[model samples]
Target: MKRFQILFFTAFLFLCANLLFAQINAPSPIPDRVVLNLTENPATSVAITWRTDVSVSEGFCELQPAAEGPLKKEDSKTFKAKTTTIKYEYGDEPVIDANQHSFIFTDLIPGKKYIYRVGASDFWSEWFEYQTPSVENDKFSFIYFGDPQNDLKSQWSRVIRSAYRHAPDCGFMLYCGDLINRAGRDVEWHEWFHAGSFIYGMVPQVMTPGNHDYNDLMLDPHWNAQFTQPTNGPKGLEGTCFVIDYKNLRIISIDSAVDSELENENGYPMQAQKVWLDSVLQANTKKWVIVTTHLPFYSPKENRDNKHLRKHFQPILEKYKVDLVLSGHDHSYGRGRVSDNPQAGHKVMYVVSVSGPKMYEAGDKDWMEHSGADKQLYQLISIDGNELSYQSYTASGELFDEFILNK
Candidate 1:
């Protein structure tokens, strides 16, 4: 009996020791997915979003000078920024849910490279570096794409890889909308990050919300959880709408979902959005203005005439002498020069493009200077002085269209 008791105690102690060892050997939650988004306020700021396996109550990132040459003591100095933890819940009974964290880094030096890394508690992620463009870098360039909506792993990766290879020098990226078919799908978001794995961690991306970007009526949980942009928009328009100023360019992003007529009478957010847009455009001190959204004002796919939007916003765009309008959702490519009032005066070119596997027949219109029906493509815009050069390239790096916008 004594020996048996001693054996039982030894077994219990061994089991406890094994449990403690297992806990110690367990892996820490590393930052699996990371994304950098550009804010409209200025080129001196950027928004970073990342995900972890467990809930993070608090998070922060350390930024260091990404300067070349040998590292010195002074070069090792670090700057830290705190992140805001955003909570998100889904389903009726609240049984299924998750939390996402984001942070905005501001007051950064433009045209300077900075290295950064995120961490939560004792878990630290790997270091990544990015450069902020100078407000005066008129020679800057960017990549514009639309709708990476379906087959994210296989098809979308090809598009993203092709764009990265062709436009490696692009300072930033713009997604017109429909990044994922369903906004609330965690798996889809994961695939999106994976598809753009090559450039996502390095390049800053500016995204507009699409119809599919929002979840079932009344909720845009995924969008709110993933992105953080300028909130200087109209009342109640918050994340769904915002603006960012890069160099001499002003990029305005609006949520057409709220602006669309699908909402109830009292939920018409477009009126307020337009009122705010008028003020923004009227108050603009920038040299050039570009507006971006998910729905196209001139689509070759679905309803060609976005009647409500055209009726309410087109006049405002023309009235403000807006230079360009970039949009997605048509699943095709269309660019046309618009002269206010059809009288041929001040002109603004509206462009609709798609970057996913989907395709739609290009409409034939006199105003349409160029249109494509079959290839998956991305656009690269280079702005130098008063000249804006636009080039649309296929996934295989073939130049499908080219145009120049003179100021």
Candidate 2:
């Protein structure tokens, strides 16, 4: 036992030294902004994405089950990564170019820890470890945030870090929308990535596109070029609108700006989404059904009422009896159901929140049970068998709000 402990300690130190050296001598071809994303079936599948300098055309990922002893390269399985060259000339700014690489690992053993790295064979990334979701109704937690869109590196970083400290073993992190202040801006994306460096590599991300994720010209081309999500959505809505099944929970991500964009420009239409959403809801077998989008169905102020989704999505969501409808874009916090009637059992809870430093004047409204403004917050949601608990926390780790739901 003593020998094993000494060997483990030595191996840990060796790994740390290698990581430090890699950071100090980071090269352009070295993978940066590496993130794990949710797949169709997270229990047996996971998607990874990373960026590199255009110098590297080919990319690779090596994976193996996490172990206590030495991590041997001989025991790892190698997979070729798909790389996309992204070049953009934003307005008058100099043209930006970068390579984005993505891969999906499937047939993973449920509930097992896996260590993996991404890069070329000659230059590999430091090992990252994450456990696959179990194939059961197991107790699990996940973090949810709204619009980490402004001052991401300085302000939004703390909210996410606080969420990690509250639930380090969370199955995933759900971003409601507006991940950055501008669409297709490299420097802003850099801030978003740099803020949550290692956390992105470890936990799988659930990203829903917000309005700012696009621009007046069209939806950001980089949206799909970056995150690798499910293609099981409607014909035109692939990665942007999809479903993920993890444990006994089913999550649906929808694009609410479609109604406007779909008519004028080529975009994911609400009608197509309605058909797909109805089908998905009908076939849902998970115990929990949560929907995330960039637009809220209800707004604290009258001017911001999301008629875009209210007329279409609100009815469908209520009909299907979804447990939670989570969204961003409001820049404030509000949580409640539509109706105030007590007899309206099996009501769907609606929540709109923000995690970035952007401030808005949130007024008290009749539809909201709890409302707040100008405060960045994150939510920790846990599901265990028949009980679901939600806790909202401030950037400083103070408990802002909480609630419990029983099945």
Local distance difference test values of all predictions, in order:
0.74, 0.84
Runs in model 1 deviating more than 4 A are 1-28, 67-98, 259-267
Write candidate 1's Cα lDDT for 1-407 as tens digits. Answer: 99999999999999999776534312235665677888765468888876654465556677778857543435544444444443344342122233355788888898888887786667767677888888674688889897888888888788888888887878888888888887565556767887888477788888877877776555456676666666778777676678787777788887776544324433547667878899899889878888888887777663476766676788889888888888888888888886437753567788988888877888776667788887788889888878889899888888989898887
What would the per-residue lDDT of candidate 2 be over residues 1-407, giving only the tens digit for each residue? 99999999999999999776534323277888889999998989899999887889999999999989898879899999998998854665445677889999999999999999999946667899999988978799999999999998888888888888888899999998789888877667778888899999999999888878878846677778778989999887778889988888889989775544334323447678888999999999988899998888777654777555665666677777789988888888989867433454556788989999997878778888888987899999999998889988888888888888887
* TM-score to native of every candidate shown: 0.85, 0.89
Predicted structure 1, TM vs. truth: 0.85
Worst 10 residues of 2 by lDDT: 259-268
How many residue pairs clash in each candidate at the backbone level?
A: 4, 0
